[model samples]
Target: MPSSFSSQMLSSGGLGLAAGLSLIVAIGVQNAFVLRQGIRQEHVGAVVAVCAVSDAVLITAGIAGLGAVVEQADGVLRWLTWFGAAFLIGYGLLAVRRALRPSAGLEAERAATTTSVAAAVSTALALTWLNPHVYLDTVVLLGSIGNGEGPSGRWWFAGGAVLASLLWFTILGYGARLLAGFMSRPSSWRILDGLVALVMLTLGVLLLVRG
Candidate 1:
């Protein structure tokens, strides 16, 4: 019986990890922002830490049943949706401006435009928290799925999900440096910033229209 239970726990954990990765590995505003920071080699550690920790907190909250509480508060979700949309749109506009006026080439030029640590951290926090979809994915979707594992398996599932987040953010933050060669070109930065702008704008518009 113990062996059988262990198998079940393992299965639950695997499912949780897979689900978490599927949700998180998507190309979204948050990922784009992180990738940009990584390419710039700015406070990469701080950015990754914030993202991983935020995911852990959100996933834990989902597992702990805070998702239900959030669901009950429709007003909160509504407010978040509107606020997030505005933030995305504004950020997208900034990206558009950057793309229109491409900066100088490579790390030296990019470094000149590097933001302060506090600003970078603040942007990371905003990107993580302002998006309503984040709550829906981490809290409502993952939470409900984790809860399905029952009492004994739920925490194990959450652990797997948290692990997935840690792995993804770490890779994204650090692995981005590998692409620095390509990103060093002015044209490359323009393309990347342009895409970021489009993604942010689309997400913002979708939120407003859907809401």
Candidate 2:
């Protein structure tokens, strides 16, 4: 009985971890922000914490029945979708401005650091909360899968999923620092910011269309 239960738990948790990673590994707006912060070594800890904690809350909320609520509350999501679309587009525009502006790599990063911690934190919060896609992914999809683990393994699955979020954000946020050396060039910043702008704009337009 013990061995069977252990196997079940491990299998369920492992699957959750894999699923969570798969969903998060993509280059999205949120990840782009985290990577930019990480590469700049500016407010990385705060950014990573915000992302991990937000994921945890969203994933847990989904498991706790918010997924069902979201499914029924179409109006709520619609508002969020519009709000998110606007925010993303605005952020993308800012990225475009940065990309077009010439910068000396480290000099630009230093300038960015002058942006108060409060500003960085605010940006992180907005990027995390304003995105409706996060809800559909974490709350609806991930939550549904975690709950599908059956009552016995559901919590275990959630644990794994939550762990995955922590691990992913931690790595992405911190791992970006590895590229700090390469990103020291002005051209690198322009290229990265350009890609970020493209991603944010595309996603924002898609959200508006979907809404």
Candidate 3:
């Protein structure tokens, strides 16, 4: 009995770690925004913390059987995808507009001053919650994998997954910020914003068009 228990525990731990790592390893739009903000070295700490904490909350919710509820809701995924796509496209358009408009140094300073922690937190939450992929990855996929384990194993799996998300967002936000100096130029911002626009438009169109 002891041996069987030990074996089960080990298996569960392995499974949890695998599930956590697999989902968090992929780069998505949220990560891209975090990276961009980080590289700009603007609100580095706030950005990383908000992103990590938001992810932790979502992962925990998924583990708490939230996945089942989400699964039962008809058209939940489709609606989420649409909302996410719209936000992305709208945000990208704003970025493109900013890139096109060259602000005076005084106006730029005032703009920077207005970027508060609350705004950062709100943005992070929006980015995290708007994405339907988060639901599929955390709630459905991770939750399914975790459900296979025993009670203790479920916690372990959740821990691993949360750890993965926290680590990735934290690192991406801080590490990318180091590049802010290089990305500070108006031309650089323009190019970066343009790419962001393209990505948002593509993702939005794809989601809306998807049957």
Candidate 4:
């Protein structure tokens, strides 16, 4: 291919990546949990990689036809919304409590237990699959958007989204521990937990009302 063609392709990839990433940047329970995992340096690589791959699969499915299928399942969507709402609210309350009544020091002094790859994979799958918003974003919104791009852009868009998820997970998981070191203050964790709680509660309420 020509130099100009190569540059154009690269530019297209960048655009696709950005679009895919934008869809998932919202503050949600899944992300909050991932961030916590990242901070703790527990199965960071596996977690990130799983999340990324899950996104790619969903995005591809959405492009393939899952969006239409989901759209047709109105009742299922409502049920999912309710369940997700409950999870969010409950999670938020716990987070708020932790923030307000923080432990004097690290709650548990313990060696890091080894997490098997299987367990890591299961956790990632649960986080991705159980979260209704993942379907809403990946299958519904992203699918619609990717379909709009037509067949040619479909692959590019999917590739970009996959790459974005991969990049985000890798960076977040690996870099979280480094940040934890800097944010050794209990106050920092409190603030973070508090913010996550607020976001989750708000989102949950919104979803409930919307449903």
User: Which structure among the candidates has the greatest lDDT?
Assistant: 1
TM-scores, all candidates, are 0.96, 0.96, 0.81, 0.82
Task: Kindly provide the TM-score of model 2 when superposed on the true structure, using C-alpha atoms.
Answer: 0.96
**Residue by residue across 71-179, what tens digits does model 3's lDDT show?**
8885877778888888877776776686577644333523653567787667777877887777878887888777767676777777777777777877888777566
Best-to-worst order by lDDT is 1, 2, 4, 3
- Residue 70, model 3, lDDT: 88
- Please, what are the lDDT tens digits per residue for candidate 1 over residues 53-107? 9999999999999999999989999999999999999999999988888567776
lDDT (0 to 1) per candidate: 0.91, 0.89, 0.72, 0.75
Give the lDDT of residue 6 in candidate 4.
Answer: 61
TM-score of 3: 0.81
Residue 79 error, candidate 1, Å: 0.6
Check candidate 4 and list the clashing pairs. none
lDDT of 2 at 90: 99
Q: Model 2: which ten-residue window has the lowest total lDDT?
A: 106-115
Model 3 lowest lDDT segment of ten: 104-113
| Candidate 1 weakest ten by summed lDDT | 102-111
Residue pairs clashing in model 3 are 38-177, 39-176, 39-177
Error of 1 at 185 (Å): 0.9
lDDT, residue 130, candidate 1: 95
